[model samples]
Target: MPPIPTPLTLTQLLNPPSRDGLLTQIVSMLSGLGFSATDWETDSDGRIILQVEAQTLADLWQAVYKIAQGGYLDTATGDWLTLLAQSQYQLTRNPPTQTIGEFRLTAAGGVGPYTFNKGDLVVTYFDPTQNNKALIYRSTNAAPVVVNPGTTRSIQVTADSPGSAYNIAPGSVLVLNTPRPGLTVDNQGTLQPAVATGAILNGPFFTAGQTLIVTSALNGGAAVGPTTFTFTADYPDMTSVANALNVLIAASPQAGRITANVLNGALSLSTILITGATAVDQITIANTGTANISVGFDTGSATSVSGAYSWISEYGQDNESDTSLITRCINKWATIGTGTKAAFISWATSADPDVQKVAVYSNLFNGTPKAGAVTLYIAGIGAFDIVSGPVHANNVYAYIFPKLPIMTELFVAPAARNTKDVVFTAKIKTQYNNDTTKNAVFNAVQNLFFRLTIGETLYKDQVIAAIITIPGIVDATLSAPGIVSDIVPAINELITLGSVTPNWLVVV
Candidate 1:
């Protein structure tokens, strides 16, 4: 090409020579190559201080190299500049450390060791004390644990503890791989070791044949087995008495069977009827192939049954055995006319009456006759004179019996004497005529009524207030007053009966 460009000397590049003369020369050369210098600082002992910024690391490296060749290197006096120059050159040749985010060492039974590439920023923690105090070796150097990147090689390590940490290789992670197997419980409440090879058994001691109720946190169960020194003798009888009892307790009423006196020869079961309106008596038993039994009514055991029978008669009446009544009373009445006598009769009666005698009867009638002697004497001659006999006047009078008025008042008292100011609404019926010829008439019937009363007052108001409205009132004439006259008075009576004051009347 042409003659090579002459290299400028340090003295010539830094014309105004001083302690920081190389910094000026380096900055001038870098600026000429399109680099900017910033954040410049120098030590007390005068030395060139400079920092240059470029678009990229590559651009920065190129600018550095160019400045070094342009007589700036001759001006550099310290070892730091040399090191910095070497480091800069190495960075330009390799990819950035930030590009490699993380690295992991994967080791399996089949897969051996491998390594990550250079410039990797990896996260790893290792304790050499745990791994036989083995030092990490790379290439030819014995290295302490370092975070920087370099050449790749397999990492080797050994465990210090043979039992706890043995066979633990470097880069190996600990994982809880499997769960513990089920444990066997003995009658003595001792837990046997888990069957799984890698399982760990932790327990409290138990007694032999004393019934081991094993309750598992994972599966709900009471495991029962014999307490033996050997594992073979710890066979679990899942269907044993203790086990069955546990199962029965765990199972729901729908699924389980309950037996009383399981071991004893004698057993009795008392059951209440599950359905039907009438009371019934019955017993049920399940043999379970373990016991024989006899069941009968034991009169001697009546005392044991007494409490239950009394309970049945009281609150437990629904469970009682139905019995026949000794005697029943039937009231008798003459049934004289329209069977009204029966309503007036008391329940007690000595004898029954004949039905036909009082069935029906007609009203009697009579006629008057004239005297015969006077008629014979006046027949011929005295026809003129006999006509003067006394004249008789005929008249008929009808006597109507008026019905007496029957007045009835209902009274409601609170069950407790102290209860007061109870408010309630009620319905009442009235018998307008004492003849008892018609049904009681009522008015203004409503379903819901307010109450401020307590106990019996609460009940009485609710009952009497239930109005009965009949379609017809006995002997009710169109010209007479409406049926309300009777209803209003009855309601007033009921209100007084309920002892509900005006202030307490919440609403009707």
Candidate 2:
């Protein structure tokens, strides 16, 4: 490994003389040799010949300067920087990718089996903050049909562009851009799962001891059933296994005709409440012995559902900036041995574009040291919080898995949030609208917190400094953080703006 070179600005590395300066020097040299300086004047034809020739020579030198700059690391940009990153360190800029998620569209009152074609769009309501710009999500499913009237169907949609500004918080994306008659959309964040309310058995009953229990919330007089069955996996929850669990419930008393509080989305067998088949304790197949199956599902309600707002999956990134590519190229060289701190960060940073701040805790968990263990606390652009979610953590872990050294254990989690509300009173300039000034102050504080990294300390004065810098704010004072000091977070924690309450006082 070669030693890193000293950093130098473009102007410092090369001083390309201006054409006028070069021309003046050329005239000065000619005049010193007894030639008339007036001959090179801009107004005369003789001047055009000598001056233009001098300018041409200067232009060639400037071109040479820029071409020479392309050979260096810090001063290079555009294609020059791209080649440096590629050739010297096997790296390339990440192209922009759109955010995509599976969203559910429910009909208000429809005929049957409505198709949301692959290119169909579901858009968020217009936002006042973003100059009334709305996020548009185009359906990716070839044919997402709602078979039954008034049923909800899941359609995968991709954002028109990768903008993570408004669709991150739960219920933040409730409004639709345009109304589709008899159809409504729900775009949620970090969801548990959609409710598969009523369940029923379709075929012959299960063998003896096979019971279908409903443990989900009882909406519209639906009762919570016995807690007889345990969940198969802890992460996926009941909804993911709903399809499989619904198929295995062939003996439940509730078989078909489930029609109460329906999300009208996916089919949950437990939500099926048909009443035709006789309850059998034991049933045998043609060549099989008595079957035993105990299937139970939660008709539980949803808070955060699978939506376009989750930002849970891929963090679609725009093309890498020149500054970022150069830094990554330099960092790439540090990852040669593959177990260094740089290796982990380089891998995680490359995972997605939203990945802004990543804190690496080597040989430590909960502040306790454990040999051969690495815990990565990551925070990125996400709905509801800056911290990365389980899905993202899993994806990051998978990306870093192949790069780990022998016998190294790795754990990845979203950075814990240290939320703080900013409470202050600001004297607003009389000309500025009180509401507008208040909103600006709030945004100023929030934007500051958003830019902070994991384990960074937030100075109370810095917060006050940020608010006062707003053009509308005449004067401001911080009160809630009564002591007036810096708020330091744990290494694995990120400071997030919870709420901003600015008491505005108008001043002439």
Candidate 3:
């Protein structure tokens, strides 16, 4: 090489340089110096205004070289100029270094006996991560003084006390010294007394129906009466008094009458009576006939005073009556008697004259009948059977009136027949009967018996849906509807089968 040309000084290269070209040339130089350039902005006259980083200066220089080789020397020169100016500006504007200090008080030294007044702030250096050094300083101190490094020292400084006095230095923290004694219940399972002077009771106690007495002494030296205080009973296990009472009511009756035992401070029942034919747990009765019979219940023996009593007059009579043909005829028509027998009798008498006999026989097929009769009447016609002795062992000796003619008069014709009407009516009647019978049976099984009606007319077409006689089973499914059917069958089945044992079955 003949001679090496000296590189231009930064100032010399840029002496009176064009502000427009300066940024570009500086950026190109920076790219060569290993700084990245991302973006560049220029003034309207092409002076570089801003430059950003996107790649390392070495990479940028390589890119610029490629561009220069591609005949983009102007772009390359502009980039170099921008980078040089930015580097020189940064060097001229370096930031000052920050100063910090660290100090610690001897462990023996704490917030002082020496007080600091208001408007005085003590300067302290502390590692935020470590405990602070306790320092004492005055508001009037002329200059900052370094505290003895390792020893505990009290530096006297005068300071005015602030209204809300607190001792805190610039880096010295404060810890609370106020007492924080926890409160707690002293007595549990009992009521707490009223808080009095100097009383320090705090609570978490179990108090149920506990009475507390509070007494106060008057300023005049007179003693006040003790004021009674009570804590409400909290029965988490049982809901309410009424609810508990209901539960008690629902529980099986204790073997005693419900008697208010004044002596025991409680309500209870008398001892169960265990004696006699009438020995019963309970009893119920319903009188359907015109005659009213008195029921004498001896709570002592749990027995009925009346022996062999009839629940329904018609049923009782029909049950005892002779089963003779003439007696049957009379029963089938005699005022439609009282219970189911009466019901059957009305049904038989209501049929057409030609159909009456057949209806009577059909009604009696599965029914109980009277014993006997000497004279039989058919459609108001009498037919006397001359018997030397009693016609039947349990025969009726007197006259047996025939059933009245079925609608001899037009005005007495039965209501118009509607299949729907019949079905609905029959269903309703049957349901009523069954319900009544069930109620009665339930009562009887519970040693409580009662009687209900089977209505004036029997639903001849109604079929028996079921006959449940399960022992100890109170609920029974009945084909019929209301009270009558329920009571009669349940009672009779219970009595006859001796299987069903429940004294009562409450229907829903």
Per-candidate TM-score against the hidden true structure: 0.10, 0.56, 0.12
lDDT of 3: 0.23
Rank by TM-score, highest first: 2, 3, 1
The true-structure Cα RMSD of candidate 2 reads 12.9
By lDDT, the candidates rank as: 2, 3, 1
Model 1 lDDT per residue over 93-161, tens place: 111111110112233333323332332212222322333233121111133322223222222222221
Error of 2 at 420 (Å): 3.7
Indicate which candidate wins on TM-score. 2
Q: In model 3, how large is the Cα lDDT of residue 56?
A: 36
The superposed Cα distance between candidate 3 and the true structure at residue 177, in angstroms, equals 73
lDDT of each: 0.20, 0.53, 0.23
What lDDT score goes with residue 493 in model 2? 62
In model 2, the Cα lDDT at residue 7 comes to 72
